[model samples]
Target: MSLWALAWTLVFVATAMGLSMWRRLGLEKDMLIAAVRATVQLMAIGYVLKFVFRVDHAALTSAMVLLMSAVAADNASRRGQRLAGRFWRVWMAVMSTEIVTLGFLLASRVIPFQPAYVIPISGMIIGNAMVASALFLNRLRGEAQARRDEMMVLLTLGATPRQASRHVVKAAVKASMIPTIDSTKTMGLVQLPGMMTGQIIAGADPIQAVRYQLLIVFALIASAAFTTMVLGALTYGRLFNEYLQPVV
Candidate 1:
């Protein structure tokens, strides 16, 4: 669409803010901030991506991907600020997820090893991994806090930290993965995914768009599961002291 067309889209944002005001939902400030922030971020990234796509250097592309992963990990780590080494755990989980997912895609020749293909897909995978890690960490921390008494009893019975917190770890991992799993199951019936819809709007064949969307859907499932599982395993031990007793 043209800039004029894009400008018209602000009407929707205005309507949202209007509704927030009318309902006294107390979200007007947040909605306004988000709208402005999204616009600025997207425009900046649009220029950056345009330049990167033009350059198309392998090292540059890889650096861009790393920057994205680092940003994602940092954002995810915010959800568990009190968890020791949370940022590194999130960074490791997200980076590993990106490597595994992209490795398969490149090795299988499902997508070409170029900025056009790698950058967008990496963004999606990294973002999903970030959400998964954040959810797992947040839930893990919550579960550990809530079940400290139970875990203390298990500790007293000679259970190790992992054994004492096994249930909490499992629950947190499962919680983190539930959204991705549910979205995959309900993809077409519940909502048309953004990638597929964008492709079709850009005049790509619907079938081809569907195929790419399927690849994304499958990758997201793996990304979310792997990120949550890895992060949960790495982080659950933090809930306990060196003496194997639950910590506050």
Candidate 2:
């Protein structure tokens, strides 16, 4: 079977968007637009990759990594700015997450150099970081806003920003980590993960497929956890007062 064997994606997208509209879920228009945008974007990306992969140049590979970083930063900054103070801080959060994740993955050989490995793994890492950053940053901001009074009280009592924002920090960490946690918990129980299923479908040994799937899952969790902690720590610190104190 080819990659296009996943034609059910279109049907699922249509069904979801349609159901959202019918149910007046407020997400209907956004979902429809997102689906359209994703299609167009992926189509363009497919052609780009076709061209990009033909070149075996080092500069080309670096360019691809840079582009991935920029896109990841854009996705994250768009989500983070409303809550994270300056645009630069959001960029820092995004970049930090990306660096920590990509660094370890590359070093560990969980993902390697060729455009095939580079593109797919980068996409997953960037996507996960984008999500974790968005959720952690937004939630931290919201909690800080809501609990400003309590935080200020703590500050007044000689607590540092780190200490005062401890509650919000914990919540942010939990929020960011939830997806990784759930994926691990549900790995072989509620559903067969796509990587394992894809490998088996491709005629690989079931044991081999299971091994690759386990590696991918663990790598994903590690990358996400690293992203969440770095972004959360960076952002939570800034949300507090200038005196290293939590704000009111």
Candidate 3:
């Protein structure tokens, strides 16, 4: 479709969905505000990305990647109710995961340093980390909050913070990991995800697209696992205190 067609398509669909959501939920103001925010935010990011991609400097590109990761992590933490320290810790974990994975991928030549490789892969991993962290932290914090008495009981019994919330933490991390796991398992069978579908639509061979899909799956697993664990661990640490106690 042409640019104008795509613009109209997006506007109409967004408007229709916003109106429907408002009517159904009786949240006209919130729905309309969110729709406006979505439109403005996407457009702003589009222009900013255009500028960033135009600059061929590695530092500039890396900075942009970091910026995106930070924003995503922040959103994840904000969407979920996490303590400030714990929230920052989750952000740190996500940042570390992105830096390490993107670093290794670039260093080892898995994904080259070009905008094409660097930008897209960073986006995928960051997006995954964002979702995984959001799921993990939200559930982890909520469960830990609910089980505050249990955590205190464990801590009073001489368990460290990590030790105190170990079971709950483990469950939350696993819960967050479930989405990625299910999606991976059902990739080609139940669904052709955006990446695979996009590749085929771009005229790539189906077999090759599947191969690429496998790589993405593996990459996602690695990013999600590392990020979820690190972020969960970090959040766990801050959600507790010096005397092997839980802040929650």
Compose the digit string of candidate 1's lDDT tens values, residues 143-228. Answer: 88888888988998999888999999998999999999999999999999999999999999999999999999999999998898
Could you give me the TM-score of model 2 versus the true structure? 0.76
Pairs of colliding residues, candidate 3: none
Tell me the lDDT of model 3 at 6: 61
Instruction: Give me the runs in candidate 2 sitting further than 4 Å from their true place.
Output: 1-36, 84-87, 200-206, 243-248
The C-alpha RMSD in Å for every predicted model, in order, reads 1.7, 3.9, 3.2
Error of 1 at 207 (Å): 0.6
For candidate 2, give the lDDT of residue 181.
81
Q: Which residue segments of model 1 deviate by more than 4 Å?
A: 21-29
How do the predictions measure up, each by TM-score? 0.94, 0.76, 0.82
Worst 10 residues of 3 by lDDT: 79-88
Top candidate (TM-score): 1
Candidate 3 structure quality by residue, lDDT tens digits, 97-141: 888887887787776787766777788888998999888877887
lDDT of 2 by residue, 191-226 (tens): 998878877988999999898777667767876777
